[model samples]
Target: MSAVLEKATFSKEAYKEAAGRLFHNEREQGYKPVGLHLYRLPTGPILYARVRMHKPAAEGVYEKLIRPFFHDGIEWKRGEPKQDNGKLLYGLADVQNLPQALVIVGEGEQKADELTKIGAGRLAGVTSGSASSASHADWSPLAGRHVLLWPDFDEPGSKYVDAIAAKLQVLGCALQRVDVAALDLPHKGDVMDWAERFRAAHDRTPTADDVLALPMTKAVPLDPPIGDPAEIDVWPAPQLLSAMTAPLDYPIESLPPRLRAAVEEVHRFVQAPLALVASTAVAALSLAIQAHVDVKRAERLTGPVGLFMLTIADSGERKSTCDTFFTRAIRDYEAEQAVDGKFVIDNYQADLAAWEANYNGVKEKIKSTAKAGKQSTTDLREELRDLEHDKPVQPKVPRLVYADVTPEALAFSLYKQWPSGGVVSAEAGIVFGSHGMGADSVMRNLATLNQLWDGNSLTIDRRTSDSYTVRGARLTVALQVQAATLRSFFDRSGALARGTGFLARFLIAWPQSTQGYRLFKDAPDDWPHLDAFNQRIADILRLPIPTDEGGNLVPVMLPLSPEAKDAWTKFHDEVEVSLRTGGELCDVRDVASKSADNAARLAALFHMFSGDTGPIAVDALENASSIAAWHLSESKRFFSELAVPEDVVHAGRLDAWLIEHCSATGAPSVSRRDAQRLGPVRKREPLAEALQVLEDLGRLRVEQMGKQITVNPALLEGVAL
Candidate 1:
């Protein structure tokens, strides 16, 4: 023999590629090789390989490779290595020696070695002997640390990760899923494949920094359930549109013939968006009749005859113009009434002075008689009683509308002008940002408005002003404001309004802007359609205002017809169904809660405007239901965006930029360097922070191959450029 060598060895470099390939293969197959060895007979060639295991090996290439052999003319066979009772995770010891090291768990020994190589010892790479044996491994070593799991892209591997995930969760390890799919890997690809692809494209392998930068999605805890199956329902993540650029479209056809024609004519005349003009028209109509009309839902139930409406739009959207156009009739009517009221006010003042003088004389005689110790005359006492009973009834002013007034002032006006009135404004700041709507007065103000919306009598007992009560009155409200101001309102007073039912009373609209398309077109002299619209408004306004014998307003009660009632009942039931568990409106239950009442009110308003004296019709109810559906859809979109977290909002902006710039160019990913430099987010730190948050949420990935940062592929799905 050349030598009686006691050991056989090979240079590590000779099998490096093979080892790398083996690592990747094991990872793909859901097996963790751990520490594998190529054994050999002393003084000879290779004998068999042994892979570290938590259980005895069954059958594989390692088992097949073992066979009897003759060494130096002596009979030999595969040798059985002694099992160690206190085995450790492959690279745990090395990792433990490093201060503040991050650890990654992969499937195979080669994968762990590759991770160690890539991380340059800063990463502790370990694996359980095999996928099936993952639960048997000593995971206690990784406890109290943030651990990342790199599972192969296959069913078996996913199952393995899931199994270990439950154990890891119980062991108190924080886990993240490093998704390679975002890297655009081939089907059944692993980390090795990703690295190889990166190396092939960039002429260098990905380093630990690259792996560390990959986006991570939170690993949902696999906590075992402890409840009946029927009682447990898993909630999947809700799918939402990436953005909402337009409001839900209202059903114009649902309007009655004249109203529909008026809306169309105004839309043509103004050359403004139909949504804006149509909404304003509805507001004007409500102002016309809400004070005099009421809907009798049941014998005991009555809805506020008026509507509370809010329209949101960007600046330069002709909001002011629409308000002026639709509400012109109300303004003209109020002007005429103002002119007529002066004479009545003067007469009332004289009459009140005379009554007071007469009453004082009677009171004086009674007091003198009582002081003289004589019985008061029956006629004098009766005169005093009559004076008190006929105390000059204050003339109810014909004020149909008020704007930019405080809550207290509005209440007083309503008390003075019985039956109905409205608060109308083109700017939301007149309402939401008014001094009366400040934090201190928010609750009191909203409570007043809420009660007004419910057709309940209101009492405003202000310490600084005269106390007053509004009885049997209806209040309509309509305002148009920029979207941002509305959001600010939501931040400040929306919660309280919702809780107090003030916000629920509004039928909100967020319409698209019609800024660029407003061509200058003159209307024919005295357009009859315009005249007809205004005339209809005038007719409604001229309807006699009703009051009880006590001078309190009385509403003309309108009942829903039998068929209409059935339809409304069915609609209410449907809405109730949506407010239940697992329903679409669950997130928007506050708005949904009042939708039926709003619908009924709309039905009544529609019936009145349609010039129908009979009970509310099925057609009217159906039309109102359609409008309610649109409002509900719009509210869902608006409220969802309103609730987006600040950080996620930034991410959304970035997402929009990515879709427009990168995704549209057939390149779904971006270099972080490019993103920071050329991204819509101008500042470096904010962009980085936003990217980090997005990565955590699995919306995007930030990676580093070398000095350059790389964003992953398809960062935004279903988003248009």
Candidate 2:
């Protein structure tokens, strides 16, 4: 009978007798018996059982006895285990029915059962098997539910609550912690102890209403802090890379008068960032005049007058509106030229058709003479050679602006159809994400663009297609892209884009967003400044581009005055000094090295666009220097931040969130548990590493004993809740 009882469920009488004997033994040993608890599925099947002795067994030194049961297609049988790891939370079967009720998480099975009985049907109670098992349990059932953690008045109990809170937070549960310090309970006391005291005082058990009356605080969200200014001077925290430096404003005053006015007017009308507007305007001016003139930076160094500008902003920043306002004149000029040159194009086509027929006729005669066994076919062959030499050339089109085009097509147009063109667009995805930038063509395309910027010739050698050499052609690129798209492009290109000097040639602007501050205003009666700007653009476009007999642009050189040259040399030396090792511009040496060239080009553009004749003046060079310096600074800020390690970036985010939480709660420190649950860094090891980084940076002081981080008081100085 004893062997049968060991292998199967005991009879009720036998079970009662065994439990009574165990209870008596525990009582005699001055230990308590917390009774037996059953682990069940939500559908009401008993999967396992635990006998809580509360005292260690003398023989095995175990605190509890676990008996797992298995079902063999019929009924549950003892002594045969089905599941090894029990992940379901204690009382999950009971809490699963009350989905809308607030869940009260406790430390042990006894406490969970007590809370459930006290709350009746109003509240749900659950535990994660034990204090250490919280991380392994499936907490999905509590997702989207409000949870309150009532930890015991001990260190282990507090850790248990923290573990549960972190898991629950990931499930999106609204959480709060009961103020255990305010209860005035003894050390290691818990809800059960308080209930006993309550029963002793009131002569009755406390209800769910009594438990709900405990003090609680709302969980803090991840955000930065506001603080007082006075403390910052004493304990200054280290600055983070994310907030290192703000971009300098675009130097609009450096632009020519008409162009500056147009930029300012468009900025006012569209309420976009001034840098964005100015970049587009400058690009438009470059497009109009690039084919007519080049800038001679030195005796042996000459480059195109065109500019490549990249503007980065979030979507809905009115990028398109700004582009349209600035490029209106360029579009109008193209349309007018297209209309006026229609007859020229028609005549060229007619001549080309007649030339092709004549050439084909000559080739046929030569073939017939050879087939007729005539040895004197030299005359017909000479006629064919003469026809090839006199073949009608295709007329150059007036299409000067393109939006979506591959690098091959753009090169073809510049080589065969037009000698000058610009790619102006607010959406850079079409250009950067296009097939022309694919793995096979990115290097070739980047080289081509680099050559165009340098005013060097491009030689296209194709075996299966018509080959051509593009010489003295000018190209301008003005692209506005979002930050994410550009970052993605950088990631895909690895180091090739920067290594090939493709990005180094561009003047970049990453201005602060002007999103929420843009209030609406009525349009002006008429834009006189814009009209003047457009008129200037049209006038520049009408100027004849110096070209060779093959229609290749041979832009005239624009030299700088003596005073302007002196000023440019000084600026160039200054930038050169900053390119040394340990210099502020060392990381961005590629961009800084080109600053002087860009300044010279900008000065030339300003000189020509302002209708100034002869050499570029000193004043224009000074203004251009200022603008170039600003863009170089922008490059430093952008690339330096990108160079920050990922761990440090995460640390910066966690630091901000910690400061914010401390400020909002008026708490001087935050628990490691709260940081993991409510802060930006959630994973355990990553959070630890981030906390270590913050500590190393002097932004935070972590107290391992209490598992909390004390924010540097200086960081909270001048900040408010």
Q: Each candidate: what lDDT?
A: 0.68, 0.75
Give each model a TM-score: 0.57, 0.60
Q: What is candidate 2's lDDT per residue for 1-721, written digit by digit as tens?
A: 1232234443334433444443453455555555666665665554445445545658656444332223323222332233223255678878778766678999877888898899888777888655545554567878888898899998867767766666676688888888888888999899889899999989999998988898876643323311123421223223333333434556676777778888888888888888888888888888988999998877888788889888876677788887777778888888888898899989998999999999888888878878889577888888888988998777776788888998888988998878899988788888988888887789998999998888788899899987888899899999988655777787778898889989899988877666645888999999988889888888888888899886778999999889998999999999898788866578899888888998998898889889999888999999999888988877776776566665775576677577657877877688888777776566788788888887776567878784978886545532332
- Give the best candidate by TM-score: 2
Can you give the lDDT of residue 355 in candidate 1?
A: 98
lDDT of 2 at 716: 51
Per-residue lDDT of candidate 1, residues 1-721 (tens digit) = 1232123234334333334443343444455444454433322343223444222256543311111111111111122222122123556654566547677787655577788778886676766534444543456767777778888777645656665566577677788878756778767677677778878998987787888899777775544522223532211111112332224356788877787888888788787667678888888888898867788776687766688888776566676787787788888998988889889989999999999999999989988888897775788899899899998877876787777898777888778754578888877787888879887889998888888888788977778767777888778898887666776777777578777777777888876545544779887566566567788889988888787886777878899999998998888889888887756677778888888888888899888877888899998998999888778877776776677754555566565566556645656566776666555455676777767666654445555552233333222222222
Deviation in angstroms for 525 in model 2? Answer: 1.6
Q: What lDDT, from 0 to 1, does candidate 1 have?
A: 0.68
